[model samples]
Target: MVLNLGGFKFEWKQTSEIAIETDFGINSQERIANFEALLSAKLGSQSINLNGQTLPFAQDGQEALKPLYALAELRQSLPLVTGLGKYLGRFAIEKISENRSVFAPNGAFFTQTFSLTLRRDYDADIA
Candidate 1:
């Protein structure tokens, strides 16, 4: 649906996945939880496709790419939100990948795909 990174916003493509991860450790004596940190978090890639050469569609591609580039440039932790302003967590952009295909007559790309990965940043007091 909608995704925002700092000041950029876009309507995401139809296919996307979100994942969260956690961990637990065992002790030799009691086989009980032995780790001070019991929870972990990770985010799945957000993918989008830009296609067509029409007025709005071509412009949408540029708009989507702008935020992705901004995330990569900004190394500091930033807020990530999804589902109509529900706060997911603070995170840093870990990686980004782009695929381009089907060049136009003028050598402009007619189809583009992008994938973005974000990693959670634990608070100082929590971790």
Candidate 2:
């Protein structure tokens, strides 16, 4: 399915790939992890805030990333990616039974197709 708001669009499918996957289907932490990883890889060699602490990278990049970091955090807490069109007036997402997704925003068409099965991180568990 595809829903287009403004110019941005989101198309969901039923693929066996999930770069941003979550078992709870509602846990916010997984989203946070995804965002943090993206920022780290995409914004490498730059200084930005992660969670609370400031992260200074070892590369050059756009100055606006600082703000993007904040936005990412906020979005992590209360995700609006699905409805970005409503707030920013441009975006879309098709709710399907797909484990994978392709996010094309602005001039960057990011595609992440992951073939993964579910396995609880028992090692990270702490009681």
Candidate 3:
């Protein structure tokens, strides 16, 4: 597995990317960069996308994807305890896209392609 978020393991499949964005304020009079907005990086809003495919070996495609569905429905932030190398933070599911292809005799999916978009959840309570 490449990473485990909140307890759901992410196995190798396709590709993953992490994105970080920042905003800066400028002084019109000085014509130069002035100050950065509070939480300029938008830590809690930054998101990452994980793409993968699930194949039925001993279990159906729907069964293999149950965990992911559960996580997305929770609508809560979860801690990052393993993988993802040096980066450590909380995350919440922002979106989930799945494509099911190939079907079994009973109509269960044989293979499923999925993409998970997760938003960073900053631990700080900025009030």
Candidate with maximal lDDT = 3
When summed lDDT is taken over every stretch of 10 residues in candidate 1, the lowest stretch is 47-56
Question: After superposition, which runs of candidate 2 have C-alpha atoms over 4 Å from their true positions?
Answer: 1-18, 24-61, 72-76, 83-127
Give candidate 1 misplaced runs (Cα > 4 Å).
Answer: 20-58, 61-63, 124-127
The digit string of per-residue lDDT tens for model 3 on 44-112 reads 245667777776654333677788789878888776544546445677888888888877798877677
Question: Candidate 2 on 2-114: residue-level lDDT in tens?
Answer: 32222222334312223333233222233643662222222111111111111112121223133433433332212122323443121112221112234345433233222
Judging by TM-score against the true structure, name the best candidate.
3
TM-score of each: 0.61, 0.19, 0.67
Backbone clash numbers for all candidates listed: 0, 5, 0
The TM-score measured for candidate 3 stands at 0.67
lDDT of 1 by residue, 43-121 (tens): 2233222222222245564345765677679786677766488876676777767766777776677666665666666
lDDT for predicted candidate 2 compared with the true structure: 0.26
Which is the winner by TM-score between candidate 1 and candidate 3? 3
User: For model 3, what is the error of residue 111's alpha carbon versus the real structure, in angstroms, after optimal superposition?
Assistant: 1.3
Instruction: Give each model's whole-structure lDDT.
Output: 0.55, 0.26, 0.65
